[model samples]
Target: MGFSAEWLSLREPADRAARDGPLAQQAAKAAGPNPLVVDFGCGTGATWRALAPYLPTGARWRFVDNEPALLAEAGRVAGENAELVEADLGEMDALPLAGASLVTASALLDLMPEAWVADLARRLDVPFYATLNYDGRMSWAPAHDDDAAVTAAFNQHQQGDKGMGPALGPNSADRTIALFEAAGFMVLSADSTWLLGPDKAPLQRELTNGIAQAANEAGAREAASWGRHRHAIADRTTCHIGHIDILALPTGNLQESTHVLR
Candidate 1:
């Protein structure tokens, strides 16, 4: 399904925090913020604000989003450092990241299948700071064991191909680490979770709906079960939690690479 402006507006803060916590920091320390950052599925430029502070002088934030509405908002949000690029990630050929110092996207990678992630990462073997992909279980307050059937069904729903080819589903969190490892990434560091509670958190809300919708779509049996499951856990509000993976991958052979490059 397509994303909503409300969704983007809601998750902006936590999204920004996730970006700041790990990937952005390492990138800034490793090579300075002047590096070219291409945000796949930029979505109103929420990720840009996080990347802004640590950024060195004259750094640029190139945002890519297929939706024109989002592009307008992203351009506005990105300010002087931002350059809005209107395009969809599925159209890999149309949107290339061969020269970018970093390729990043928040809550975007899991939406696509394994092949596409591989394709994009292959295009640019640079550091990628990807975060907020839902891992399919959310429990707040007292906390409890996650509903297995609901989790399984919901995961299938999340993986329900949103057209860019079959997505990696809730499992993408784990899959991403493996993907990066095989890609020759050195694996700098990571933030494995984004937990949300009754704090009325923005990203929490975005992910709550995602988990519920997935449960609803998985099938009637699961839909009915998760409905009660959610209600029963009212004592402790719960929703899917997302994780961030930060990497400092070398582009074009790190061993032979120089600090200064073309």
Candidate 2:
């Protein structure tokens, strides 16, 4: 199923907070002036919203997604500087990367398979910055007995086909890094983890329900009960979800940038 605009809206704040600033700056610097940035799987243009401030005003944006409704919503916010394209992300050959100074995606790579990701890496001649790739690590401040089971089941569900063969899921970041490195790109990476507290009850509630649904699908019998418990305590519970951001530049394109993790 495609992500709804409401869900993207709810998580946008957390996504903004969780992004790695230095990595974004590095990407912006590499892009230079008057660049064309192409975003894949662009959900309501959240990636653009997060990165726009750091990028040059002359930068133009191309947001691509399979869902026309989502593209429409993205276009509404991105205005004249943004061009929205409704296209299937499953078809990598059709990606609009021509004349792109930088290519980006947020919360996207984890849903694709290794072969697809590798093909994308090989196709990229410009700098690539991918953010918020799920790392499969999740935790709660007040842990429950069924947390491990629920988490395991949810992760299993994550690897299921997402219209791009078997998804890499949690392995996305590392695998993409290796593929880019092997393709002769210099890669830098950093943790972009979400630290959710009581103040983030809305997002935590949605996350709790979503995880429970995935767990139920994966045959976790306690999913319903776990969901109920988590949802009830959303006001007090703290959640930590791990994500990674990657900035890969073609070798000899930018030799002065150092690899640092923060």
Candidate 3:
């Protein structure tokens, strides 16, 4: 399913906050001076904004996305040092990675199949920084009876084809780590959970609706009622959604390897 610009915009702040800043810094440092960074599924260039400050001032970026509107917004957000490439990531074999110092994607892996990720790992010899992959942990304050049922159903839906074959869903992070490791890369990971409270009611509401919809579609009989009950208490509730941030360093250079934070 295509994500709307509005939804991407709405989630930018939380996405930024939930990423691993130190890992990003390490990735930047490892890229050397004037690194060429290629970002996949880059929506509105949020990844650029999140990592630019920690990178070299002269760092150049290439933002890739299939959606023209998002590419336009990415150009605006990423400014003159950035170039935009409009391409579908589902077409894995055709993905461009030549001369890239680092390859990055945010909240994207979970939507891809295992084979696609393996192919990507084998294709790129550069270090990779991927963030916000769902890790299967979710919690709601003052838990409801149907929370488990709804969550299970939603996760089931997540594994279904999202135009990229069968999605890895919560298994994306582990799959990525294994793929990179098998390719001889050194990988590190950290938690980047979203802790949402009343202040983020809008995001919470949107998430609730999305989960409910996905659950219902996945054949959860209690999904509709669960959605209504969650919405009723959303204003006063807090949520914790788990995610993982991974940095995979290219093998072969010990001197450059020191740049990666353990």
Candidate 4:
């Protein structure tokens, strides 16, 4: 339950991205004429809000998530512009919306393995106008590059397997690229890196928790190693950072394609 109500209170996803240069540029590239934008894993609808301006006016957004509390909060945040679905990805399976354009997810993808992506892409009717997902990109402040021993240990720890099948925070970017291409996508692939300085608290905190989660999970088998990190994060004296690979690909070009113009 790391994604608490307190986390949502800290800031809006829109404002967080507005303040970030690299993310803003990538987001602009994802904009244009997407009519029915489906945001998978749309927690609190913050990701939707961040990409809302880019979608066509009078367009409706479909947000899917399994958490009722999160979906309810998203409903409250999104109002009329949003259609919240409180079920798994299976709830509203992907089927080309004929003219409907694009599918987006932020800070997801990495958690899932290749099979899930394949199924979703097939359902969505592959070759999405664009897709951007970020993950485990939590960072700590007063970052100590000099703390190599702890940091390296922590980096390896964070990049370690999350028992979710594939190692998410480690090398997911490459896997994502290959999967998309294999699915018949003409992809624009790039790594989207988010660096947090002390000024940005919410993003910074998210990074912090994410790093702590990774490290904790990574080192769970070793109690002594795990306990040390748990204590340090509670004390709040470290910094963390991570990256997500961004991809923009056309769909139905290979597996199947469709166009939606507003």
**What TM-score against the true fold does each predicted structure earn?**
0.81, 0.96, 0.95, 0.67
Candidate topping lDDT:
2
Q: Model 3 segments beyond 4 Å from truth?
A: 253-262
Per-residue lDDT of 1-262 in model 1, one digit per residue for the tens?
Answer: 4588987777665555554354556665544445788888887777677666777777777888888888888888667777777876788898857567777777877788988877755666667777677666544555434456556777788787788677887777667767766776655545546544556444544454556667777772655545555555444574435565555465443332222210
Instruction: Estimate the lDDT of model 3.
Output: 0.87
Residue runs of model 2 more than 4 Å from their true location after superposition: none
Q: Lowest-lDDT window of 10 residues in candidate 3?
A: 253-262
Question: Would you list the rank order by TM-score, best first?
Answer: 2, 3, 1, 4
As for candidate 1, its clashing pairs are 112-167, 138-239
Q: Using alpha carbons, what is the TM-score of model 2?
A: 0.96
The TM-score leader among the candidates is 2
Better of 1 and 2 by TM-score: 2
lDDT of 2 at 124: 89
Worst 10 residues of 1 by lDDT: 253-262
Local error of candidate 4 at 71, Å?
A: 1.1
Report how far off residue 103 is in candidate 2 (Å): 0.3
At residue 76, candidate 4 shows an lDDT of 86
| lDDT accuracy of residue 78 in candidate 4 | 76
What is the C-alpha lDDT profile of model 2 across 61-180, one tens digit per residue?
Answer: 999998998998888988998898888888888889898999999998888999988998898899999999998999998999999999999989999998768998888999999999
